[model samples]
Target: MSLPPKTALITVGATAPFPALISASLAPAFLSTLSSLGYTHLLIQHGLTPTNFGGTPSGQSLLSSLTNLSTTSPLKITAFDFTPNLSSEIATSDLIISHAGSGSILEALRHVKRLVVVPNEDLMDNHQKELAGELEAQGYLIEGRVDNLPEAIKKAERATFKHFPRSGSEVFGRIVEEELGFEAEG
Candidate 1:
């Protein structure tokens, strides 16, 4: 695949009310790996705005860190205050690192881009981790923690997500089925 030399990844908040835990940070590792891959472009916006709507502290923190790293790294990084027209963003990016948030994941999948999922443990109730794990299992996402974050990011960058097409259909179907109390027939 003739992917881009650089990429941008974004992590969003969880949907489940509890708030994801900010336990293990994965952005740095992600960025470093991209750098190692000879990527000249990388952007990470941590806390973005309201999902379908606009920004929170975590979102702010993510933005801050992304911007900070961009300023320091040799590459130029672009950080969004919140969700800034993600369709366009991901379509142009080669990779995206996002939380298990429904909105974020869906957007990435829509673009058929590779994604590294770092579940939000701060706001959510330990659900994102499971979600991330499941995605990893399904070959739709690359989930990691501080322990092997670097390795995970590298894996993500190198991974060829053949299941890109299924990502959106499955996830979207499940969400709709669950909401409508209907069994999703995949």
Candidate 2:
């Protein structure tokens, strides 16, 4: 019997476009890795930049070219620029690969999805790296680089993650209070 179809979602956020992450996620090696891991579909939120990457077409243009690209693996690929219903996509996905923006990270965590975070190294200040590193250190997600995504995918397949507390939950409140040294009043 065939295994049930599994979906992996990749989000690069809506403000700054991450061409490297998008390119890596769609690479033949990466798709093959996902296929071996039983993922049959790939959905990418490619963000809203029209810029090309080092003379190569990127952003919407790259996504348009995906149909002509050939891979040995039968991973179905699709992409969108932006959406208000990203939460629904996250809920349906068995795995998530995202740029290390805090909003994207938190959104995936809130859904308790298995996440692989790749911080865009080209961004100013490089804060995404710090956030991805901390989250990986905490066991909430796997931190991946553009060149090493295949390895990261292998790790994520066997990894178990810490449950992220829901917003406004008592656990979240307590953790915040403890961190801030605020005492609860009876």
Off by over 4 Å in 2: 51-61, 70-73, 167-186
Give the Å error, residue 129, model 2: 0.7
Please provide, for model 2 over 1-186, each residue's C-alpha lDDT reduced to its tens digit, 9 standing for 90 to 100. Answer: 989999999998988978788778767688888988889898988886443453223343573457655344488888788889998999999999999877788788899999999989999867778767767877889999999999998998889999986652565445435444579888
Error at 119, model 2, angstroms: 0.7
Ten-residue stretch with the least lDDT total in model 2: 51-60
Cα misplacement distance, residue 155 of candidate 2 (Å): 0.7
lDDT of 1 by residue, 70-173 (tens): 56775677644446466777788877767666677777877778887766556535666766676677777788654565677689877877455644667655
- Candidate achieving the largest lDDT: 2
Alpha-carbon runs more than 4 Å astray in model 1: 1-5, 13-30, 48-71, 170-172, 175-186
Q: What lDDT does the true structure give each of the candidates?
A: 0.59, 0.80
